[model samples]
Target: MAAQGVFITFEGIDGSGKSTQARRLADHLRAIGRDVVLTREPGGSPGAEEIRRLVLEGDPDRWSAETEILLFTAARRDHLEKTIAPALAAGKAVICDRFADSTRLYQGITRGDLRGVVDQLHALMIGREPDLTFIIDMDPALGLARAKGRNGAEERFEDFGEALQQKMRAGFLDLAREFADRCVVVDGNRGIDAVAADVARLADGRLG
Candidate 1:
């Protein structure tokens, strides 16, 4: 039988470059003959993608914070079942752009007292965690500026602005500390290539 696959996830503020790094690392792994499945949260699978549109698009206040959290959890469950599980069972390394960390931070900041609820829902519906998670650390101002430069239909979360971005960054850093066993903090305030290279190096270490 093939060996168990490696699961890696990227987490950070909206524009911390985690997505790009995730792609770069996937490419690096594939170039070295490693089977890789690159995907993203909230939309990796078909059902989850539809949920993503509902939760990310439309009025910022379309759904209450609590409802939004439920939507995210359902979408995550779908992503896990339909995309992540099958890929891993096939012994293919999976690199996801974002995961439950985003939900924790977003819900924690939005709902204020929902952190415990977030944890409970995650454990109940999606108990699995990535083998390695890279939290791209960077200044919120820089990240927000980067996000603004690439405004898209998903501006719902970015509308929180710099203040919320700062809070989210702190949340991700705190998660890195709390889950140090599988979380790595990569400095992401530099240029894209530099950050991608650093992430790739760290991921390579994990693979070996």
Candidate 2:
């Protein structure tokens, strides 16, 4: 059967420009006369947006790994029901800045077991998988530096030490390996236009 709509997710460590590229891809698709919805994880729907603020801004010291995972799942459930599923059902391509893979990487690093976290999220998702995922791979040190240069209020996760950031980077790579067929790891060290071009090509290929 033909797909109802194409779902593409972008993922990466902080400063990897996943959000920027995701937006670029959405614009490119719209330019080509495709219906598209551009959104993000943990905050696409109203209910999910509340959860997102709590998860991102709440006290990190008080959050346990288990609690973090469950909160992420809760937000994802709402996002799926209120944003993703509807768009796909209507035949609009959905380009998400981050999604399930973010949970896998962030929670896996915090929990110390990539496979277990992936399994739990997969079960929670009930088979809703992205048609394609682009992992904007970036060096941890460089990424963190870039993130710091952005000069924004630090979220709880952003306050994590260098070691934790490195672990998260590793977690993302591990996830890409485990889901090799669906994941494309794009090097993110290039200029924005160059990176956007690569993402545009990928989206164009799928939407063609």
Candidate 3:
């Protein structure tokens, strides 16, 4: 059967404010009477949330790129089975902070050329993509600063430092082009309200 709900995801380098934008979009949709579920990965469902700490709270080199791919794919599969699929089946809009696109870059190119492995695992396990994605583009250096300033436990990825963040920013832009039909590159260097406004406008158009 055709899916009855909308699946929207936000992607960007750490601290690009995609998370905030995702929340705003979900709240906006819900206020308008749409059933919305806001979630994130490598942790969405119960099992996935457990995996999130393992992947996100350790040292930067704690997990090899290959190992991270397997872990992330496992978490994604659980999230789909327990959260995303059910929400869509129930005709609710699902706004995800990050999805497979993140794995495709983080585990795909960061340590080495492992994107093919990530893709294969995804196809074998998760086998889905967001219907709409907002790739929040930002300056890598500034984004890294902002991310670290939060002093969050999930600073493992941020600890990879500016170089990795630069690579990630470029990788996200490339993915936006590669998936242009469903991806929108939003300038996240702007103020929060401005960025959120653009996001809401684009999302409303799509949801309409």
Candidate number of the best lDDT:
3
Q: What are the RMSDs of all candidates, in order?
A: 1.5, 1.9, 1.2
Candidate 2, overall lDDT? 0.81
Better of 1 and 2 by lDDT: 1
Error of 2 at 55 (Å): 0.9
Please identify model 3 stretches exceeding 4 Å from their true place. Answer: 1-3
Put down candidate 1 lDDT per residue, 126-177, tens digits, no spaces: 9999999999998999888888789689878788778889888888889999
The better-scoring model by lDDT among 1 and 3 is 3
Ranking by TM-score: 3, 1, 2
Query: Candidate 2 residues 15-68, lDDT tens each?
Result: 888889999988898998888999997789999898888777746565777677
lDDT of each: 0.88, 0.81, 0.93
TM-score of each: 0.96, 0.92, 0.98
Model 1 clashing residue pairs (backbone): none
Error of 1 at 148 (Å): 1.5
Backbone clashes in each candidate structure, one number apiece? 0, 0, 0
Model 3 per-residue lDDT tens digits across residues 1-208: 2248889999999989999999999889988998889999889899999999999997888989999999999999999999999999999999999999999999998779999999999899988888999999999999999999999899999998999999999999999999998999999999999999999999888878
